[model samples]
Target: MRVAALWFPDWPVQAAKLECDDELQEPLVIAAQHRVVVCSQAARAAGIRRGMKVRHAQAAAPELTVIDANPDRDGRMFASLAGSLDDVAASVEVLRPGLVVADLKAAGAFHGGEDVALEMLVDAAARRGIDTLAGAADEIATAVIAARSGQVVPPGESAAYLARQPLAVLTAETALAADADTVKTLGQLGITTLGELAAIPPAAMTTRFGVHGAHIHRIAAAAPDRRVAPELPVADLAVAITPEDPIERVDAAAFAARALAASLHERLKEAGRNCVRLKVVAELETGQRVERVWRTREALTESATADRVRWQLDGWLTSGGAGAITSLILEPLELMAPDAVGELWADRASTDDARRVVERVQSQLGIDAVLQPRLIGGRGVAERIQLVPFGEAAPPVEEKTWPGAIPAPLPARLGGGIDHPASRVTLIDATGKPVIVTAEALLAGEPYALAWGDKKYLLTGWAGPWPVDEGWWASDANRHRVARLQAVGREGGPQGDVTGWLLVWSRRSWRVEAVY
Candidate 1:
C-alpha cells in the first residue's frame, strides 16, 4: 500500500490567523486546557514552545497573543483545503485538520510518476494559498514521518528511512497511533531511535507492551502494510432534513446540521457499520445547490460528522454566494465495519448490538452511568477489578508481576464492601471457638462450620491461607495484613447445594471476600 501524506505546518496557528486578520503578524499561541497546544513561528522565535503553560508562555513573550483552541474552527477552515486535494487524488483521507493522506499508486500512474503526483498535490494546496509538504512511501506511518522532513522515500526504502528518525516521531500528530507516555518510556529505556525500536524482537515487544507494542514494532520494521479497505455506500442509508424555517444565521444552520448528523450516524450504527466518507448537500432558497465530500482516515464519529456539516453551512452562508438554506441532506459515500477484533467463536454482531444499546443508555443518562470492568495490578480481588466509564479506554497496567495477587480461577462474585453486613461472616472450629489467622500466617484451627448472616453451614473442604502484607510503608490506617482462604460449605439447616466461599481474616475479624 504505497501512500502519500500532505502536512500543513502550524495548522492551528494558521487556522487562528484565518479567523482574525489582526493576529497574523502577532506572536500567536493556541491554548487548550491552560497549556499551549501549538505556537506560531513568531511565538517560537520568542522562546514560546508547545506544551508550555499558557501563563508562562505569555510571561516569556510579553507580546504573545493567546487564542483559545477551537477544533471545530480548525476543521471548518480546512474543509476547503481538503476539498482542493480531491482534484489531485480521488482517495484523499484526512487524518486530522491539517494532515491528509491518500493512496499514491493510482495517482502516480495517471500523473506520469510518483514524484510528479506528489508535486501535483503540493501545487493543489498552494493554489489555495496554503503551504503543503508532501511525501510518499510504502507505508502510511513512514509517509507521514517523511512529510515532516519534506523527503520522498524511494520504493522499498521505508524501513531504512524510518530508522534514522527520532523516537519522538512516533508521537507525531500524523504518525503511528502511539501515545506520548509510551514514546517517553521507550526513550528512557535507551531506545531513542526507530532503528533501536525495530531491532527488538517482535515477540519481546508484544510480551512487554501487549498489542500496542506489537503494532509499533511492525510499523518500525516496515512489515507488509494492511490494504486500505473502502466500502461503497448504499443509497438507502442517506438521510435528509428540511427545517421548518429557512436557516440564515450560522447558529441556526449549526443546529440543523447537528440534527442531520445525529440522524445519519444513528442509521449507520443501526446497520452495524461506520462511515469513511460523508457527503454534505445544501439547497438554497433560490433553488441553488452546493455540496462537498469529506473523507477521514478513521471512522467518523457523530461530533466529527456534525462539525463537517456545520462548517460547510457556515462557509456557504458566510461567503455571501448563497441565500438561506431551505433543505439539507447528508449521505454516507463510503462505509466500513467496526475495527475491533473479536474472538473466533464470539458473536461479533450481537456484541456490537449490545454496545450500541449501552452507548444509547449512556447518552441518555450520563457517561458515568454505565461502567465497565478493567483488571489492574493489585493483591486483593476487589482492588484488582476497577470500574471505568463504558466507552473509555482502559488504563495501562504497569506492574506485570504482582507477587501476592490471587491465583486464577478468580472468584465469580465479590462481597458488597468491607463494612457491609452481607460481607461479614464467622468461622468456627469444632469446639465453637472462632478460627483466626496468626501473625505467622498460619490458621489457628481447622474450620468446622461457617455462620453467614442467618444461615449456618458445615465446612466440607478448604485451601491455604494466602498471606498478603501490603502498604507497610504507609500509616497504620492504610496498612493491610490479611490472609485469604477458599472454603467449600454445605447447608446445615437444609439439604442444599454446596457453595464455595472466599474468606478473609483481617483486623481480628472474619469476612466473606468473594464467592465462587
Candidate 2:
C-alpha cells in the first residue's frame, strides 16, 4: 500500500498564528492556556521548540511571534483545508487541527506518481496558506514518521530503514523512562534493526516490558503494515466545542449548536455528501453534556439550525441553571448523495409552513405555548391526543377507528358540567317545549327542540352519544356519555341569518356544549 501522511507540525500553535499574524511567514511560536503548542519552522531553526513554555521560547528567540490557541477557529480552518483536498486524495482523514492522512496509492498514479503527488499535495496546502510536509511509505506509521522527520524509504525497505532509528523514534520515551535505570536507548541496545527487535521472543518480552513495550517492538518491526489496508471512505465529519468559560444558562447550547451545524454544513459540502441526521452533543461548562439528534432531508439552514439550538438551550436554561456550555459536538449519523432528491413535495411544503407558524407562535407566546397535536389510540379523549413540540417528529398516526367511534365531525374538544356517566336531560325547543327522542325518531330527522341553560332552541340536527368508557382498569368505573345539539335565530331577527347551531345536551337540564 502506498500511504501518505500530512503532518501539521504544531497545529494549535499554527492555528493561533494564522489568527493574529495574517502577514506572518516568519518563525513563530504560539502558546495557549499557558502551554507552548507550536513552533514555526523558523522558530525551530532558531532553537525554539514546541512544548517549551512561551517564556522559554521567547528567551530562545526574542523576536518569536506567539499566538493563543483557539480550537473553534482552528477546527473551522482545518475543515476548510480538508475540503480543498477532495479533488486530490481518494480519502482524507484528519488526525487533528494540522495533520491529515490521505490514501495516495491511486492518487499518486493519477497525479503522475509519488513525487508529483507529493508536490501537488504540498502545493495544495500552500494554496490554503497552511504549511505541511508529505511523506509516502508502504505503511501508514512509517509514512507518518517520514512526514514528521522528512525521511523517505522505498517499498520493501521500510523495516530496513526503521532499523537505525532509536527507541525515541518509536515515541515511547517518557519522563519516567528517561529517569529510570534500565537506561538503554533503543540505539544502545544494539536492536537498531527492526528485524533484530522482532527477533526478541514475544512471550518473554511481554513479561519484561509489559504490553506497550511489546506493542512498540511490533511497530518497530513494521507489523502494522501487514494489517493496515487503505482506510474505508469516510462518510461524515464531527467537531466538538469546549468553551473556555463555563456557561451557566441553557441558552448557550443554542449558540454551540449553531456553530456546530455550520461546521457540519461546510464539511458535508466538501465531501460532496448530504446529511439527513445530525447528532448534537452540548456540554455545559460545568460538565453537563446533553446529546440530541434532529432528522432532516437537507442541511439545515443556518437560521433554522440556530433556532432549534436555541430551543434546546432555552429548555435547559429554564429547566435548570446549567453552568456555561463547556463543549458542543455535532456528528452526522446518516449520509445521502449530495444530489439526492425527495418525492414528498406537498408534505414538505406543508411541514415547512407549519414550522414557520410554530416559530412565530413560540416567539409571541412562551416556548411552551406552541405544540403539535399527536393522535393516539385510546378511550379517553385526552389520552387519545397528545401535544408535543412542533419541531419534534409527530408520533405515528394510529389506524384506530374504535367500534363506538364518535360522529363524522367530532368536536375539537368536549366539555360540560363534570365528567361522569349516567347523566341525563330532556330535549326541548327554543321556546322550552320538550321533544321526545326515540331510537326511530333519532334516526328519522333532526329534532326541533332541545332545552339548555334555562332556554330552549330548535335542533337543526343531532348526532352521536358514542359512549366512550375510559380507565377500565381503574378502581372507579365511568358512565355512558352522549352528544346532541340545538339551533336558534340570529340576534337580528328570523329574517336574519340562522345563528350557528350549538351542541345541546340530551338529558333533563340541557346545556349548550358547542357553537358551529
Candidate 3:
C-alpha cells in the first residue's frame, strides 16, 4: 500500500499557541511532569529541547514561556485539522494529535499525481495558518520518516529512502518507535542507521530483540506494509430518538440523548465492536438539520458518546439560528473489534453478567437510582470516596502527592450516617481533663479514657495527633483544621475485648470518625 503521512511539527506547542494566544514569535515550551515535551522554533533556537527539565529549559532561555501540557486541548484543537484532510484523502487515520496517515494511491490518481496531492494537503493546512509537511512512500513507516524532511520517496524506493535515515528516526513520536532500551542497545552496538539494522539477519534480530527487532527490520527492508484501517462504513448501527415534544431545553435533550447513547452502545456491545468516530444528527422544529462528527483516538464509551450528543444539542438549541430539536440521531461512522484497543481478563464472564444485571436495574429505575463508589484523591477516607451514577464514567481524579493523607490500615467501619446516631465521644487525660490537639499540632495530654454517651472505656494504648489543615483558602465556614488519633480501649474488666477507635478533634470536640 502506498501511504502518505501529514505531520505538524511541535503540535502541542502549536495547539497551545492557538488556544491560549501565546505569541509564536516568543520562546515557548509545553511542559508535563516538570519536563519539556514540545517547544516552538524560537525556543529550539535558544537551545531548549524536548525532554529537558523545565527548570533547565528556563535556565537556557531566560524568556521562555512554559505552558502545562494538556493532551485533551491538543486533541480538541487538532480534530478540525484531521477532519479537513477528508477533503483530499478517501480516508484519514490520525496517528496522533498532529500526525495523520492515509492511503495515497487514490488521492494521487484523483489529484493528477502524488506530488500534487501532497502539495494540496500542505496548502490546506497553510490556509488555516498552520505549517504541515507531507511525504508519500510505499510503506507507512518510511513515509512518516520522509515527512520529517518533506521528502517523497519514489514508489519502489522506500527501502532506499529508509536506509539513509538515522535509527533515531524510530523515536519520532510515532507508534512505530522501538522501546528506549532497544534503541539504546542498538546504538551501542554501532547500528546507527536503519540500513545497518536491516543488514542483520532477520532471525538474528528476532533472537536478539524479540518481536520489536523483527518488526523494525521489516520496516527498514520496506516489506509489504500494513494496510491503513480507515473508518468503517456506518453499517446499521445508527440509533435515533424523536421526542413527542420539541426538545427546546438542554436538560430534556440530555435525557433523550442519554437513552439514545445507551441503546447505541448496547448494539455495539452485542456486535462485539466499538466506535472511534460518531456522527450526531439533530433535526430542528423548523425543518433545519444540523450535524457534526466527533472523533477520538480511542473508542468512545457510552458516557462519552452521550456527553458529545448533549453538547451538540446544547450548541444547536442555544444558537438563535436553530429552533427546538425534534429529532436526534447517533451513528457510529468508524468501527473496530473490541480487542483493537484492549480487553480485561479472560475470566470476566461473571463481571459481564453483573454489569448486565445492574444495567437492567438502571433501566427499570432511574439512571441516578444506582450508584457506584469510586476512589478519589483526598486526604481523608470519607473524602476520598465519591458516589457516581452506575454505567457512567467517573470524574477524573487529579494526580496529587497528598503529603498529609491518612495512613493505611483504614478503619473497618465508618461512624457517620443519617440513619446511625453520631458516635460522639470525649477523650480525657489522666487527671480527668479533656485531651486536646494544641495549635502546634501536638497532643496537650495523653488520652486516658474514651467517653461515649453513658459508657466510658479506659484507653490502654494510643498514637498520633496527626494533623491536616485543609481548604485554608476557602471561607471560614468551609475551612477545616483537624487532627486525628488512633486509640485502643477496653470497655469492661481487664479481660474485656479490645476495640480500636479513630477519633477526630474538630470544632473543639472529640468525635468518633471510624472503628476498627
Candidate 4:
C-alpha cells in the first residue's frame, strides 16, 4: 500500500512559540541536558545546530534564548496536529512529535488525487502555522526516505531508490531511528551499505539480530510491509449516581464524585480501556443541570479522575447553584487502551498534601470560600475568571463580542481578587494623575503607577487603554462605557517589586482590578 510521511522539522521550538504570547525576537533554541535539540531558523543562521553542545551554541550566539525541551509539552501540542490529520486521512500513525506516516492512497483518493491531497493536508498544517514536508512512495520506508530527501519515488521503484541511498539515510525519520542501530551492527559485520546488507540471507540476518534483523533485511530490499493504524473512536461509557437525599454539602458531593470516578475507572480497566476525555453531568433539585467537558493528553489515573469530578462538584454547589444535586454522572467521551496513553506521574507526598488541604478548607470555611475559578477570556479582569462553588457551573458571561478582551498572560491574584473588599488601590497615569474614563469610552491618560495602601508602584511596561462601549446605545441614561489597561510595575521604583496589575476605568474613575 502507498503511504506518505509528513515531517515537522522543529516541533519543540514551534510548541514553545505557540505557548508564548509575546513574539519571540531573539534567536531561540530548545536544549535537553546541555545539548541542542532544536533551534529557531535565526539561531541556525547564527551557527547553532541540533546535537551541538549547549555551551558551544550559547557561546557562538550569546543572545540565543535557551528553553528546556519538555516531552510532555511536545506530545500535548502534537495532538492537535494529529487530530487534524485524522480528519483527512483514513489511517495515521504518529511516529513522534515531528513525523507521522499516513495511508496515501486513501487520503489521496478522498481529496481526488495525491497532489491535491498533499496540498489539502499542507493547508491544514498551515492553518495552525505549522510547516511540514511530505513525500509518498509504495512502501512506508521509501516514503520516509522520500520525505526527508524531497523525492517522490515511483510506485514500483522503491527498491532501486532505497538501494542507491546510504545506510545513514535511515536516521532521518523517527520510525526508522531504532533500526538504524542495526545498520551500525551490520557495519561491524562488514556490511556497511544497503545493497551489501540486502545480500545477506534472511535466516542469517534473523540469526544475527533476531526479529529486528529480519525487519531490517526487508528495509534493505526496499519492501515494506506495514499499515497505518487509525485512532479509536470515542466510546460513551457512563456511570451515574443518585443519592437518597439531595447532596447539599461539598464533602457529600465530592464523595459521590470520587466513588463514581473509581467505579468508572474499574469498569474501563476491566474492558481493557482508559479515558482521556470526560464529561461531568449534574442535575440539581431545582431542576437545573450543569455539564462540562475535561480532557488531558495523558491518561487520567483514578485520583486524577476523582479530583476533576470533585472540582466540578465544588464549583456547582458553591456558586449559589441554589439547590442540592439530586444526581450526578461521569462519562468518558474518548477511550483508548492503557498502553496507548502516557501517564504523567506526580509525587505522592505533594499529591496527598494538596488533597488534605482541599478537604480541610472545605470543612472549616463555608462552601463559598472553597470555590474554584473557571479560566476564560473577557474585557475586564473580573470577567476573566468566574468563581463558582467548587463543583458548580461558572457564572455565564454574555456571548456577545468583547471588543476589548485582554490577550492572555492574564494578571495573577489571590483570594477574592484585586477588589477583595478588604483592600484598595488607586490607578494613576504617568504624570502621577488619577486615571479615569469619560462617557464616550475615552481614557483620560495612559496608566503608569499604582497606589495600594502605603506601597507605591511605578509602571515599567504595559499595554492597552483598550476601550469598551457596552450598553452605549441604550435609550435611557443607563449607557455605560469603560477603558481597560494592563500595566506592570515594581514597588519602590522600576526595580523594587515586580508584578502585573489590571486596571479599569469606569464610573468616571479608575481602580485596581487584579494583581499578577
Candidate 5:
C-alpha cells in the first residue's frame, strides 16, 4: 500500500489565533487552560518554546501576545478542512485536533501518481490559507516522519530512509528534549539503521522501555505485520462554519446559514449520500460554541440543507443570540446514498422521501423543537431520557436506581401543567431543624420570614411537602443530601402557584456513565 502522512505543525495555536485582534504572524504562543500550548516559529527564534511556563514565555519575549487555545474551535475548523478534502480524496481520516491522513492508493493513482496527489493536497490546503507538509512511503510510520521532516521516501526503501532520522521523531513525547549529555539521534544509536534496529532482540527492548520501547523498535524496523487501515469512511457528516464578520443581528445569521447549507450540499453530493442527522455549529464571537443536532430526513438539495441551517441559526439567534456570530457549519450525521428518481411507487417512502420529511420538519419548526428520546441515568423526571438527534445512536443508559428513590419517567418536559389546581404555602420561623411550614399561615395569614430569598410574604393555602429519597445505601442518606422538597408559593404568582420545584439535585444526575 502507498501510505501518506500529512502533518499540520502548530495547527491548534495558529487556528486559535485566527479570530484574535492581532494578526498573530510574529512571536506568539497559546496557553491552554493555563499551560503552554504552542509557540510560533518567531517565538522559537526568540528562545520562547512550546510547553514553557506562561510566565517564563513572557519573560523570554516581552512583546509576545498569548492567546488561550480553544481546542473545540480548532477541532471543528480542522474537521472542515478535512471535509473539504473529501472532494479530492476517497477518504479523509482526522488525527487529533490538527493532523489528518488521506489514503492515496486510489486518489493518487488516478491523479497521475503520488507526486501529483501531494501537489494537489498542497494546492487544496493553500486555498484555505493553510500550509501543510506531506510525505509518502510504503509504511505509514515512515510517511509520518517524512512529512514532519519535509522529506519523501521512495517506495520499497522505507527501512533505509528511516535509518538516518533521529530517534526523537519516533518517540511519543510531546515535548522534545534530551535527558542527558549522552543524548544521541536515532541515526547515532548502536543500531545505526532501521534494518539494524529491527534486528535488536524484541525481549531486550521490551524490558528496557516497556511497550513504548518495543513500539519504537517496530517502527524503526518497518515491521511487516503492522497494518494501517484506510481512513474510516465517516459514519455521519458533521460541519461547522465561521463568518468573515461578526453576526451582531439575528437575521443576519440566517443569511450565513444559507451559505453553509450550500457548502454541505456539495460535500454530500461528492460522498454519494443523503442525510437524516444534521448538526449545526455556531461559532460565537466569545469563542464559545452554540451547537445542536437534530434528526431529519435525507436532504435532496443544497437548499434543503440550507433551510435546516437557517432554522438552527434562527433558533440560536433568538435565544439570546450569544453576543456575536463568527461562523456556521452544517453536518449530516445520518446519511444514505441518494436514490434514483422515479425508482419507487408513490405509496412507498423511499430513502430520499424519508430524508425529505426530516429536512422539512427541521426547517419548519426549529431544530430543538423536535427531539428523540435518548436514555440517561437519573431519578429526576427531567434527568432520565435525554433529547438527541433522531436516527442517531442513543447514549447507553446505566443502572442508577436508588433503593427508595421516586420512580421517574423518561424524557420529561418542564414547566407545563401541575397535577392539581393552584395552591399556596408558607414558612413559619424559617430557621433550622424540622423546619416549620404552617397551613393556616398560607391560608390567608402572614409568615414571619422566608429563607431562600430572605424575603417576607403573606401565606394563603398549603400543599404536602413531597419527600424524595435517593442513594439509600450510600453516604448521601446520612448527610440528608439524598432528599428533596417541593413547596407551593407564599406570594409571587398570578393565583399563588409554585413557580419552581426545589430538589437536593443529586450529583449522580450530572455524571452520566455510558457502557460501550
Candidate 6:
C-alpha cells in the first residue's frame, strides 16, 4: 500500500513558461484573485513569494511579469504527458497542477525498486523539461508532504514523518476534505502541528468539522486506505458500417456516417464519456484505404462527429481517388467525463438531438453551401453582415471598435436580398422625392414609403443616421462613407404586420434588405 507522489514546484509558472514562445527574462508570477500562487525563480530571488499579495509581489519585484493563473491551461498542458508517464507508473492519478499520486510499490516494482523508480520518474520528467520531485511513503498524505519537502519516509513511518510537518502540506489536495480556514482554526486551538491535531479523538473532531475533520484524522493516522486511487477509465467507443452497396458519392456516404455517428454517440452517452477526436476510416471498393483524423477544442456532439467523417470522405472522394467507401469505421480517440469541467470551462449537459438534425443538414450541403450571418465590424448593414460557413468559429467580429458600426437588432438579409431572392425596390420621402443620405451623414428627406416590384408598403417609424467613414486614408482602398437607419413597416402581402428592418444609406441611395 505504499504511496508515491510527484510534485512540480510552481507548476502554473512552469506551465506558463513552457507555453510562452518568447524568452521570459523578467521576474514572473502567476496570480489568481490577487493572491500569488506560483512565481518564477527570479521572482523568488526578488522576494516575490507564494501567498504574497500580487501587489506586494509586484512591489517586491518592480520588473515582475504578472500572468493570470489558469488551472485549465496547466491541466491541458500536463495531459500531453500522460502517455509518457503511463509506462513509468501504471496507475497514476493527477492530483492537481503540480501533484500526482501513484501506487508506490507498483511503480517501484515496475522499474526494479523504489529508489530506481523515483530516479527514473525524475529523469523522465526532466527529459520533458518539467522539474519533478518524488517521494514515497506507506500513506498518500505522507507521500505528498515528502514530495513537497523533498523527503522520503520508510514504510509504516508516514504518521511519525507527518507529525512534524505543518497543516499547510494539504494545500494541493483541492477542496475535497478541509478548507484553508480549518487550518487556521486548528492553529488557533493551540493544535499548532499535525501531531497535536492527530492526538484529538476522531469522534470529537467529527462533531466539530464533520466528515472533513474525520478525513483529516484518517490522513494523520496514515491508514491503509490512504493509497492513491487510479483515474477513472475512459470508455472506448467505435462504430463500423458496411452498406449493401459500395457508396461512391460523398452525399450517399454521409448518411451512413451520420447513422453510425449517432449510434456511437448514444453508446458514449450511456457510458458517460464525451469524445473530442474522431478517426474516420473508409475501405474503398478498389481496395484502397483512406483514413483521416479530426479534432475539436470542444467535445463533439453526434452531428459534429458525423460532419468530420463526411468532410474526410468528401476530400478523399473529390480528389479523383478511385474509391468508394465499402466499409466505414469511426473511432473516438479521446473521452472525458462530462462533469469533469462542470460548465465552468465547458457545458457538461448533453445537447438536444433536434440541433443534430440542423447540423447534419449543414454537413450534407457542404460547409460553404450553408452559411450563418455574423456581425463583423463594418459601415453598412450589408458590409457588417458577413456570411460564414456554418459550425465554423466566427471570424474576429468585434476585435476593434469600428466607431460608427451599426448596433444590433441586426438584419437577416442584405440589399438585393443576399440570403433571399432579389427584387426591384424604391425608397421615397414623405414629399414623394427619393430618399438619400449625404456624405456628411445627413439624410436628404425622411422616408415615408417603400416600393418593391408591384407591392408597396408604408413606412411606420424611423430612427438614426449613424455614420461610419472607413478606409479614407488609403488611395486604393474602397473608401465608404455610410449611414445606417432602423425602421418599422408592414408588407403589402396578406397577413401584413409591422416588423423592424435594418436599413442602410450607401451610394447616395437608401435600401433595406431585411425584415426583422
Top candidate when judged by TM-score against the true structure: 1
The digit string of per-residue lDDT tens for model 6 on 1-516 reads 877777887778777776663355568888877888888777888988789998888788788899998754565455433324555776565544466666768977778898887777766666334567788888766787788777889987888887887776654455123445566677788876678788899899889875557877777767566345432345567889999988887678678868887788777767767775556678888887755444453467666676656655655665464477789988776676653222332332234222343454443444466677786666556666677876676645457665665667566655564333343356789789987777667778888877766767788888887876677886645785656678776777334767676766655555565557
**Every model's TM-score:** 0.60, 0.42, 0.56, 0.46, 0.43, 0.46
Winner on lDDT between 4 and 6 is: 4
Model 4 residue 6 lDDT score: 82
Instruction: Give the root-mean-square deviation of each candidate in angstroms.
Output: 11.3, 23.2, 9.6, 20.6, 18.5, 12.9
Model 1 off-target regions past 4 Å?
A: 21-23, 127-130, 226-229, 232-238, 242-249, 268-300, 312-516
Cα error, residue 203 of model 6, in Å, equals: 1.1
Tally clashes: model 6. 0
Give lDDT for model 6: 0.67
Clash count for candidate 5 is 16
Cα error of candidate 6 at position 322, Å:
29
lDDT of 1 by residue, 63-149 (tens): 888888887788777765666666778777666678878779878888898888888888887733345788888987788888988
Instruction: Give the per-residue lDDT digits (tens) of candidate 2, residues 283-360.
Output: 765665655444442344444455544554454444344445666677766666633233435543335344544554
lDDT of 5 at 199: 72
The worst-scoring run of ten residues by lDDT in candidate 3 lies at 340-349
Give the best candidate by lDDT: 1
Pairs with backbone N, CA or C atoms under 3 Å apart (clashes), candidate 1:
none
Q: Choose 3 or 6, whichever is better by TM-score.
A: 3
Error of 2 at 511 (Å): 68
Counting only residues 3 or more apart in sequence or on different chains, how many pairs clash (N, Cα, C under 3 Å) in candidate 2? 30
Off by over 4 Å in 5: 19-22, 127-129, 172-196, 203-211, 225-516
